[model samples]
Each structure stands twice: as C-alpha cells, then as structure tokens.
Target: MENFDAIVIGSGQGGNPLAKKMAEKGWKIALVEQRQPGGTCINDGCTPTKTMIASARIAHLLSRSDTWGIRNQGYTVDLPAIIARKNEVVQQFRNGTVKNLEKAGVTVLMGTAVFSGVKTLTVTMHDGSIRELTATHIFINTGAAPFIPEIPGLRDVPYLTSTSLQEEVKVPPELIILGGGYIALEMGQLYRRLGSTVTIVEKSAQLMSKEDPDVAAVIKKILEAEDIEVYTATTTEKISGTQDHIEVQLQTAGKSHIITGTHLLVATGRNPQTAALQLSKTNVTLDEKGYVQVNDQLETSCPGIYAIGDVKPGPAFTHISYNDHLILYKNLFEEAELSTKTRQLPYCMFTDPQLGRIGLSETSARQAGYPVKVAHLSMDKVARAIETGETAGFMKAVVHEHTGQILGAAVIGTEGGEIMSVLQMAMLGGITATQLRDMIFAHPLYAESLNNLFMTLEK
Candidate 1:
C-alpha cells in the first residue's frame, strides 16, 4: 500500500485546486478522475454553455441587422459550425487542465475510485486493474448530475440531459425543454436563435423562480418577445417518444395539453455525484438530500476528509467551489484564517438581460425582521441603457433604514452580471448607500445605474 499526505477525488474545479495547493505545500498527492481532467464546468457545464450562448447571441443580433440600418438578407445561423466551435473550446481547456495537473506534480489517476475504508481508496483503472492508496487526508469534490424526475415512461423515452446535449452537433427543428431555471432559459434561447422552435415547460408559477419575482417577470417578458413558448404552473404528466419525436402530455391550470417536438431536453436541477463514491465506508455523513455535510472549513465528518462543489451542502457554483479550495488549503498549510462563512458570494443567470443577485433579496430581508429600506430604479432612466437600446429591466437596493449600510441588491438588465460585482463588494465590505451615492462614477456606463439607485434612497 502506498501512502501520501493527501488524496483528492474528482478532478474538477474543486479537486484540481486543492490538489495543487497540497502539492505546493510539499505533500505527496494523488488526484483521481474517472472522466476528463477538468470537472463538469470545463467539460460539459459552464464553458460549453457560455460558448453556445455567445454564438446564439451573435446570431440573434445578425438576424436583426436591419435594425442597425444595415440592409442584410438571407441570414442563417450555421448550427453545425457553432457546435464545432464549442467542441474546440472545450477540448482546449481539457488539454490545458491535464497539462497543468502534470506540471504541478500531482499524480493523475484515470479511473473510478471507491472508498475502501476511511482514509483509504481502491481505484479501478480503465484497463480493469485495481490499486489501493492511503492518505492522511481525502478531498471529495465529485460534482453533480442533472436531476431527472421519476415521471412515467420518461427514462425509456429519448431525451437529452445537459451533459449529453453538449455533445450533440445537430439542431432539431423543434425542441421541448423541461424546466425554467438558468439552463432552460439559456438553452431555450440558444436553440430558438439557432432556428429551432423552442418550448419551455416550468412546473413552478414563475420561471427562474429563485430570483425575485419582479426580476423573473422581466426575464419572462424578454423570452416571450423572442417567441420561445413558455408554460408556467405546469406539470409533465407523461412523456412518450418514437425514434424521431417526443409527445409530451402536460397539465396546467386544470387544463390538459399535448405538445410534440423532435427533441426533448431536461434542464431540471442537479443532485450530488456521491452515489458512486460509496460514502457508507467512510465516517462522512450525507444530508437528507444526499449532499455531503461539511463544516464551514469544508471538512467532512471524517477527519481530514473534505467535500466541495455540488457534492457539498451549499450553493453549487464554480466560484464557490474555488472558494472551498482556498478555505481548505489555508487551514491545511497557511496560518491565515479562512472559512466559507466569511465570504459573501453572488450568483447570476446568463440569459439575455441577465438576472443576478447577491446577499439577500427584499423579501428575505423583511422576513429576517430588519427595518429595510428599498431603492428601486428602472433601467429606462439610465442614459447608457437608452443609448445602447437595451433598457428593459430594473435595479433595486435593500438597505438598513437607520445605518444606510447596503443589505442586498437584485438586478435584471443587460450587463446585470457585471454590474452586480460592485454591489457584491459593497455588501461584503459593509459599504453604505450614502457612500455609493457620493462616489464619482464614469459617464455613460451601466455601472452608473448603481449611483442612480443609491440616489433614490431616503437618507
């Protein structure tokens, strides 16, 4: 049996960084991965989705080139070319990830790893050979997979999850998406712009239900304007499929409707990738939802065993997973104080006129029993938005009425994701609205929206 200072399971954002940090600390480390080097974010999730979104956005603008006073005709989006470009981007990053891991002196074990016992792993190599390794510490960063509900006949039907959809190069004439979160919104828009008839079925009352109701409404309007059919407060009663097309039986508001599409895409939520790890052998515990329970330091119940990313019980974001790396690394080597509880993270949905929020929303703030003051500003009033012809959303800041300290912010507009960073910093640094209002901002920028938002606050 070979022993090392540390072993990291799964080579995604979380595992990769932790392995490097431990190795840099002069610890012999083994990084195990069953698939490609980079985790889902690089291989299937964030990178590919964003690349496709960029192509779709460009296609959308070109389709409306006449609005820019350019007389263009016979514009078409080359779906296969877009898919080819996405694949190239994914492959480049995957190769880079492998190169970096090798350069960092981390042993890359390409196989499925299972817990033989606490602090021990039995890896089954692709060639059908098994090897056992022991370590003082083990980090589990196995990410997540798309959550498919147990609807009758849904599994046997031909459908694509987010992972499989990334590998598809052909565009179907009609696509039916089942969910209304970020993935559904993004993919729905992409397929629609790429010349596919897209339909979205959301089981909730509002799409992007995690966002504030007003912000979600704005996004809903933009999606409808793009001609992507959206059905909210609906449920997929049953799904039947032939080799070429899928027939969906759906019910909404006491009415039954049947929709037929050439392709079905499931954009539901995700569940932790822990089933394969066989956690029963370790002291690490799982929550009711199957996510590994970790403390603020990212340490699991088992000593020296940590969990990060979607497999852990927290927000599942790439950046959050990266933050988990920093926390674990600091506690292991550096004397610097680090914990997940010390950070204020932000999340954004990448759709046209994106939706982003950090800290708390107005609803959550009031529910927490704080005397909250709200400052809401519509993007129509911002000069930059009017000049760019993208004024279709709003920004709202929630603050403590007495102290003027920014409590939270919710934004929905073009460049919403970029603009949220400023508010996120303010919330993290405990900056006040009065300070933001008095700060000099550059002229004719969407960031000036924050200045306008703070100006409306009651001092």
Candidate 2:
C-alpha cells in the first residue's frame, strides 16, 4: 500500500494539471491513467479530429479553386496520409503530457482503479499486477466516452464511434452518420468535404437543439448547400450491414424508408466514464444519468473528494474542464474563494463557417424573462467577408434593454470564432451594445462587422 496527498484518477485536462500543481506545491501525487495521458481532447476529441478536419477543409478549398481565381484541374485526397498526420499530432501531444507529468515528480500509474473504501483504491495495474493506494483527497476526472446508442444490429455489426472514426485510414465513399449534434455536424462536413457522400440522421426535431432556430437554420443551409443530406425528426428503425455496405431503416411521418452507405458513424453523444470506478464503496453519489454530482465549488458529496471535467454534470468542453482545475486549485491550495458557477461558457464548432457562441442565445435570454434587444447582421455586409468571398453566415448579439449590458452573442462566418471572442471579451467586461457600435474598429476584418451588428439594434 502507498499513501499520497492526493490520488487523481484519469489524466484529463483537469486532473493532469491539478496533479502537477499539487506536486509543484510539494505534495505527493499519484496520477493514474488507464489510457493515453491527455484525456479525450488531446487524444481523440480535439487534436486528431481537428487535424483531419483541417485536411478536409484544404480539400474543400482546393475543390473550389476556380472561385479563388486559381486554376486546378482536380485534386485527390490521400486518406491514409491524412490519418497518419493526425496520428502523429496526437502522439506528440500525448508524449509531451506524459513527459510533463513525470518531470513534475508525480507517481504516474497506468491502471484501472476502483474504490475499496473511503479514500482507498485498488488499482489493477496495466502490467497485470494489483496495487493499493490511498490519499487524503481524491479527484475524479475520468472524462466521457462516445455513447453508442442501442439500435438493432448496430453493436453486432462494425460501426464507428467518434473515437474509432479518428483512426480510420480509408475514407468511406458514402457515410451515414447517426445523431445531428456537434459531432455529427463536424464529421458530416469533414467526410463530405473529403469526397464522400454524407447523410446525417437526427432524432431531434432540429440540429443543435440548444441553439435558437435561426442559428440552426443557418448551419443547416450551409450543410445543404454543400450537398450534405440532413434528416431531422427521423428515427432509426434498425441497422444492418457490413463494412462495405451498411443499411439503416428510418421512420418519419408514419412512413418507413431505407438508406445504405459505405460506412456508419454513430455520433449520438457521450456518457461519463464512471461505471468502472466502483464508486459504491465510497460516499460519492451520482446522478440519475450517472454523472458525478458536485456543488458550485466542484466538490463531490464526499468532503475531500472532487469531480471535474466530463465526468461531472456540466458542459463537456475542454476549456470548461481546464477552468474547473483553476477553480479547484485556487480554493484548495491558495485558500482563495472561487466557484464554477460564475465562469462564462464559450465554444466553437469547427465547421467551414464556424459557430462561436457565448452565454445565452436570443431565445434563451427572452425565455429567462430578460427584457432583451437583439442586433443581427449578415456576413455579406462585412468587407472582409466580401473580399474573401466567404459570405455564408451572420452575427447576432443579445442584450438587456434596461441594463444596456451585452448578454450573449453568436457568430457564424469566416473567422466567426475569432469574431465571437471579441464579443465574448466585451461581455466579460460588461460592455454594452451601444458602446460597441460607437467604438471605432479597424476595417477589412471580420471583427469590424461587430460595429454594424450592434448598430442594427432598435434605436
């Protein structure tokens, strides 16, 4: 048996940094990881996926070389090479993370851990040995895994989840993606741009149900314009097939139909990876959906045990998880008062015309009983968008009419994510829409459009 100041299960964005910070503070640390060092974001979620998406984006641009006054007869996509590059990038990140943890004087253990008693764990080491460990404080940051929904024949047959799809070297000629969430939209655009016919089937009435209707509409239009088929409010009756040929039965409007594709991608969603931890032995309590329940300060039901990242009930973005680390570090080590409740949520979907959002949408602000004013402008009105000929989306901002404070904003166009960050900073500083409109911004940039976007508000 070994004892440490803390035992951090899962080397995720939160756990890894927290473990290193504790070690740097002269605390004994046991950093455990069953898989790659850097959690989903570095391994399968962000790094590898975005690398491939960048390649796909290149393919898309090259395919449209004519519009850019460039002459290109045709272009070919080497799927294996693209996937190799992605793998190389993932390896670099993972190696760096592992090295950093080792240098921090952390006892890095490769194992699956289960709670044997309060503050005690039985770790089944990767080399097939059993070890015991205990710590004063335990932190769970196991993160989440791709949720493969139960569709008849889906499990028995070979289908790809978001994780498995990352290692796929051969691009399917035709791909059918299940679920129209962020994963589906991203992979749909990715494969479609990579010269595959892609179709998205979503059970919800609309894609990205959390967003306002107009926001979703713009994304849908962009996908459809690229010839990517989207089927919303559609249920999958059953799925059957082999790798070369897969079929899915669908039900919509009391009618049934069949569609076949060369490959299947299940992008439904993700579930927290908590079942294996055997938390029953501890005082930690989980919610109905199996996420570790935590307070505003991110402390679990147990006094010294904490939960962060996707394993806890909250937004499953890497940035959120990293922020959780900051909150815990300051409060635990620095004796600073900090809470996760007040942090702003900002995320961007990596579509051609990226969708960057922060805080509430117009729909949400009004629904929450805030007397709101909205300002909206199309990308065509932006000089940079026009000069680049990538005018396919718009910008929108929501503000409290009485307080004049910017509430939320969403941008969907070229460099939309960067443009949205400008508004996000403004919101953070309590800047008002009128203030933004009146301020002079440099021309020939997507951010300059913010002035026009705010100016369109009711005067």
Candidate 3:
C-alpha cells in the first residue's frame, strides 16, 4: 500500500496540471493514466483532429484555387502523409505532457484505477501488477470517450469512431457519418476534403441541434455547397456491412431508406468516463446519465474527493477542462474563493466557417426573458471576407435593448474563433454595443466587422 497527498486518476488537461502543481508544492502526487499520458485532447481529440484538419483545409483551398487567381495543375491528398503528420503532432504533445509531470516529481502510474473504498484505489498496472494507493485527496478527470449508439447489426459490422478514424491510413472513398454534432461535421468535412463522398445523417431536425435553427440551417447550406449530402430528421435503424463496404438502413418520415458507403462513422456524442470507477464503493454521487456529480467547487459528495473536466456535467470543451483545474487549485491551495458558476462558457466548432460562440444565444436570451436587440452582418459585408473570397457566414450579437450590454454573440466565418475572442474580451470588460460600434480597428480585418455588427443594433 502506498499513500500520497493526492491521487489523480487520469492525466487529462485538468488532472495533469493539478498533479504537477501539487507535486511542485511538496505534496506527494500520483497521476494514473490507463492509456497515453496526455489524455483525449492530446492523444486523439483536439491535437490529432485539428492537425489533420489543417491538412484537409489546404486540400480544400487548392481545389478552389481558381477563385484565388492561383494557377496550379492539381494536387492529390496523401492520406498516409496526413495521418503520419497528425501522429507526429500527437506524439510531440504526449512527450511534453510526460516530461512536465516527471519534472514536477509526480509519480506517473501507467494503469487503470478503480475505487476500493473512500479515498482508496486499486490499480491494475499495464505490466500485470496490482498496486494499492490511498490519498488524502483524490481527483477524477478521466474525461470522455466517443459514444457508439446501439443499433441492430452495428456490432457485427466494422464501424469507425472519432478516435479510430484518425488512425486510418486510407481515406474512405465514401463515408457515412451517423451524427450531426460538431465532431461528426468536422470528421465529415475532413474526409470529404480528403476525396471521400461524405454523407451526414442527423436524427434531429437540423445539424448542430443545439445552435439556433438559422445557424444550423446556414451550416447545412455551407456543407451542401461543398457537395456533402446531409439527411436530417433521419433515424438509423440498422447497420450491416464489412470493412470498406458498409450498408445502413435508415428511416425518415416513416419511409425506409438504404445507403452504402466505404466506411461508417458513428459520431453521436461522448459520455463521461465514469463507468470504470467503482463509485458505488464511495459516497460520490452520479447523475442519471453517469456523469460525476460535483459542486460548484468541483467537490463530490464524498469528502476529499473531486471530479473535474468532462467527468463532471456541463460543457466538455478542452478549455473548460483546463479552467476547471484553475478553479479547483485556487480554492484548495490558495484559499481563493472560486467556483464553476458564473464562468462564461465559450466554445468553437471547427468547421470551415468555424462556429464560435459565447454566453447566451439570441434564441436562448429571448426564451430567458431578456429584452435583446440583435446585431447581424453577413460575411459578405466584411471587407476581409470579400477579399478572401470565402464569404459564407455571418456575425451576430445579442445586446440588452436598454443597457446596450452585449449579452451574447456568435461568429461563423473565416477565423471565427479569433474574431469571437475579441468579442469575448469586450464582454469580459463589460463593453457595450454603443462603445464597440465606434471603436476604430485596423481596416479590412474580420474583427472590424464588429463595428458594423454592433451598429445594426442601434438602427
């Protein structure tokens, strides 16, 4: 039996930083990771996917090079090369994570951890050894995994997931994605650009169902413009096929439809990684959906134990996971009063015209009884978008009608995330719509659209 000041089960964004910081502060910390040390964001999620997306984006741009007045014969996408580069990037991140923990003197345990009792754990090591550990404090940041929905014959057929797809060396000639969320859209666009005929089947009425109907509609239009087929309000009844030749039976509006593709990707969603933890042995509570129940301070019902990042309920962005560590660390070590509440939620969907959002949506604001005036501008209105010839989205903000406060905003265009961050800073500083409307920014930049955007609310 080994005892430590803290035992972090999962070296995710939150857990790793906390473990390192705790160890540096002279607290004995043991960080257990079942797979790669860097967790999902580094090993599979953001790092690998975005690295491949960069390659895909270049392919897309070159395909439409004529519009940009660039003369080129043609170029072919090398799937193996793209996968190799992505693997290199992922490995780089993994190496850094391991180095950081080692330098901080954290005991990095390569094993799967399960609870034995309150503040106690039994780990099954990768080398087939058992290790018992108990800690004064325990943090669970196991993160999430790609969810595979249950459908008839799904298990019998070889299907790809968000993670497995990234490992594939060959691009599917025809790809069918069985979800319409951000992950599905990203992977769909990636494969489509890599020379695959991509089809997205969304059970909801629209893609990105959480976004406003108009937002989702515009996104669907963008994808369709790229020759990607989208099927909404469609139920996938069953799946049947072998690798490189997959078949799916779908039902839509009470009509049966069948589709076949070279590959099938199930990108429904991700559930918290709590199933492996024997929480039943402790007082920690979980929601009906299996997410760890934590307070604003990230404390579980079980004393001295906490859950952070995607393991707990709420938004599951990498930034959110990283910020969880800040909140927990400040509260525990620095005696700083902090919490998850009242923290602005910002997220970006990495489509070609990225969907960057923060705070409430116009739809959500109105539903919440906020009297809001909306500012809207099409991407064509922005000089930069016009010059780049990539004008395909909009910039929108919701402002308090009376106070002129920016309530929420969404940017869906080229470099949308960067543009949205400018607005986020404005919101953080409590800058009103009137002030932003007159602010002078460098001309012909996407951010200059903010002036024109906020100007709409006044008119």
Put down candidate 3 lDDT per residue, 88-197, tens digits, no spaces: 98988999999999999999999999999998999999999999999999999999998888899998998989999888888888999999999999999989999999
Candidate 2 differs from the real structure by a C-alpha RMSD in angstroms, to one decimal, of 1.0
| Per-model C-alpha RMSD | 1.4, 1.0, 0.9
Residue 235, candidate 2: Cα error in Å is: 0.9
Q: Give the range of the ten consecutive residues with the poorest summed lDDT in model 2.
A: 163-172
Model 1 quality (TM-score): 0.97
C-alpha lDDT values of all predictions: 0.87, 0.91, 0.92
Which residue runs of candidate 2 sit more than 4 Å off their true CA positions?
none
lDDT of 2 by residue, 74-94 (tens): 988999999989989989999
Write down the TM-score for model 2.
Answer: 0.98
Q: Which residue pairs does candidate 2 place in steric collision?
A: none
TM-score for each of the candidates? 0.97, 0.98, 0.99
Cα TM-score of candidate 3: 0.99
Q: Ranking under lDDT, best-scoring first?
A: 3, 2, 1
**Candidate 2 at 389: error in angstroms?**
1.0
